[model samples]
Target: MHPARRSAGWMQTRFFVMKKKLLSLILTGLGILVLPNAALGAEPKTIGELVTKISNALYSAMSGIVLIAWIVIAFLYLTAWGSPEKLKTAHHAVIWAAVGTAILVLYKSIEPIIKNALGV
Candidate 1:
C-alpha cells in the first residue's frame, strides 16, 4: 500500500512539472511575439482579416522596429552555433547588428526622416 501511494505521488509530481514547463514555454513565446507589438501600439488579433492592426504612426514604427530586431537576433543565433565558418558568419552578424543598432538609435533621434520616408 505504501509503495502504491509513493507511485501515485510521483506521478502527480511529474504531471505538475510537465504542466509548469508547458505553461512557461507558452508564456515566453507570447512575450517574445506579442508583448512589443502591444507596447508599440500594435494589436494582434486572430479573428480579424489582417494579423496585426496598427493604431498610431509612432506605434506602427515601433512595431516595425521590434520585428526587425527579432529577425536580426534570430539570424545571429542561427549562425552562432557549430563550425568555424558558422562562427565567422556569426561575427559578421554581430557587426551588422551593431550597425543596425546604430541606425535604430539615429532613427529615434531623427523622426523627421522616418516621417518623410514613410510619407506620413
Candidate 2:
C-alpha cells in the first residue's frame, strides 16, 4: 500500500534470500567435506571420537577453503580493472585468508605435541 511499507517488505525479502543462500552454501560445504570421510568409513561411535573426527574434518576443510580463497583473491586482484574498492577488498581477503591458513597450520603442527601431552 504505502511506498515506504512496500520498500521495507522488499528489503526484508532480500535479506531472507541472502540468509538462505548463505546457509545453503555452508551446508553444502560441510557435506562436501564430510562425504569423503563418510565414504572412507570413518564412523564415530563415541562422543570423543565424534569430536575428534569433526575437528579433523573441519581442519581439512578449512585448509582447502583457505587455499581456494587465496586463489580467488589473486584473481580478484589481477582482474580488478584498477578499481580501488575491488583492490582494497582483495587485499583484505588475502590478509585474512593468510592469517587463517597460518593458524590452521600451526595448530596441525602442534597437534602431535598436544596429543602426546594428553596421552590420547
Candidate 3:
C-alpha cells in the first residue's frame, strides 16, 4: 500500500476507536445520572418499575446501535479515503448519525428529568 494511504487508514481507525470510546463513556455517565432511585420507594411491579425496565432495554439497544455504527463508519471511512468526495460524504453521515443517536439516547436516559424540568 502507498505510504500516504496507509497512514490515513491508521489514523481513521484510531480516530473511530477514540470516538467510540468517548461516546460510550458519555452514555454511561448519562445512564448513571438519569436512573431513578425508585428502588428505595417504589414497588417492583408498579408502572414506574415497568417504565424503568423499558428504559433499560432501550439503553441496551442504543448501546448496541452505537457499536454497530462505529464498525460501519470505520469500514466506510477506510474504503472511501481514496476518493475525497466519498470520504467526505461518509464522514458527514457518520458524524450526523452519531449526533442523532446521542440525542436519542440522552432523551431516553433522562426522560424523567425532562418531564420534571418541563413540569409535564
Candidate 4:
C-alpha cells in the first residue's frame, strides 16, 4: 500500500469514530435531561397529579412575581421625592401590574371550571 493512501484511510477511520462518540454523548446527555426523577425508581405521578403539580408551580410563580412587582412599585413611589415624572411612571407600572394580576386570577379561577366541563 502507498504511504499516502494508508494515512488517508487512517484519518477517515478516526473521523468516523469521533463522529460516533459525539452522537453517543449527545444522546446520553439528552436522556439525562429529559428523564424524570421518578423514571429512575421513585414513584411516578399520574396524569392528573402531574397537571396539578404543574399548575400549582405556575400559580405560585405568578403570585410571587406580582408580590415582588408591587414591592418594587412601592419603592419607586417612596423614592419619587416629589418628581412628577417618576410618580407618573410608577403609577403606570402599578396599573399594568394590576392588570397582569387580574389576568392571573382569572386564569386560575377559570381553569378548574374548564377542566370540569371538559371532564379532564
Candidate 5:
C-alpha cells in the first residue's frame, strides 16, 4: 500500500511489457527474413547450388545483424549523451560494427572466387 512499493511494482510491470514487445518484434523480423526464402525457393539439385544457397542465406542473416548492430550503436551514442564512459562504450560498438561490415563486404567480394573454386 506504500507509494514506493507501488512505484516499484509499476516499474517491474513496465519492464516486463517492454521485454515481451522486444522479443515479439525480433521474432517477427526473423520470420519476415527467413520464411519467404525457406518456402519460396526451389530445392538445390547440385552441390554447388546448395553451397551457394546456404552462403546467400548466411550473407542475408549477417547483413541483417550488421544493420541491427549499427542501430544499437546509434542508440548507445544517443543515450550516452555527455557521459565519458558511455561514449567510450559507444565508440567501441561503432568500431566493432565497422569491422563486421567490412567482413561482410569482403565475403561478398570473394563470392565470385568461391563460385569459381567450386566450379559452379
Candidate 6:
C-alpha cells in the first residue's frame, strides 16, 4: 500500500478509537449522575412532574458541563504563557463558555415563567 494511504487509514482508525473512548466516558459520567436518582428517588406520578424532573436533570448536566468548560478554559489561559496563538485560543474558549453560561442562565430564568404559564 502507498505510505500516504496507510497513514490515512491509521489516522481514521485512531479517530474512531478516540470517538469510542469519548462516548464511553460520557455514558459513564451520565450513569453516575442518573442511576442513583433512578434507583432511590420516587417515581413521578404526573406528566408535569416527570417533565420537571427531566428538565432538572438536564439543567444539572448542563451546569456541570459548563463548570468543566470554565475549568478547562482557565487551564488553557494559565498555560498559554504569553503565546499569542494559545492566548487567542483560550480567549475564544472563554467567549464560548460565557455564551454557554448565558444560555443556561436564560433557561433558568425562563423556566419559572414557563412553569407558571403551563400551571405545572
Q: Let me know the TM-score candidate 5 reaches against the reference structure.
A: 0.74
Per-candidate local distance difference test: 0.57, 0.73, 0.69, 0.69, 0.80, 0.77
Give per-residue CA lDDT, model 1, range 1-120, as digits (tens).
699899878976886686678557655654566555556653444322122233233444544555555555565565355668767776776677677667665655455554455655
Identify the candidate with maximal TM-score: 5
| Candidate 3 stretches greater than 4 Å from native | 1-44, 114-120
Q: Write the per-residue lDDT of candidate 4 for residues 9-94, one digit (tens) a residue.
A: 89768866865785577556545543443344433266555555556556656665676577668767866768999999999999
Each candidate's root-mean-square deviation in Å? 12.1, 7.9, 7.7, 19.0, 4.0, 6.8
Best by lDDT: 5
Select the stronger candidate by lDDT from 2 and 6: 6
Which 10-residue window in model 5 sums to the lowest lDDT? 31-40
Instruction: Please estimate how well model 5 matches the true structure, expressed as its whole-model Cα lDDT.
Output: 0.80
For model 2, what is the alpha-carbon lDDT of residue 35? 74
Q: Please, what's the RMSD in Å of model 4?
A: 19.0
* TM-score against truth, every candidate: 0.35, 0.55, 0.52, 0.56, 0.74, 0.63
Error of 4 at 61 (Å): 0.4
Q: What residue runs in model 4 are displaced by over 4 Å at the alpha carbon?
A: 1-45
Runs in model 2 deviating more than 4 A are: 1-33, 42-52
* lDDT (10s digit) by residue, model 6, range 9-117: 8977886786678657765775677665566578899767776777777787787688768866876786676999999999999999999999998876766676777
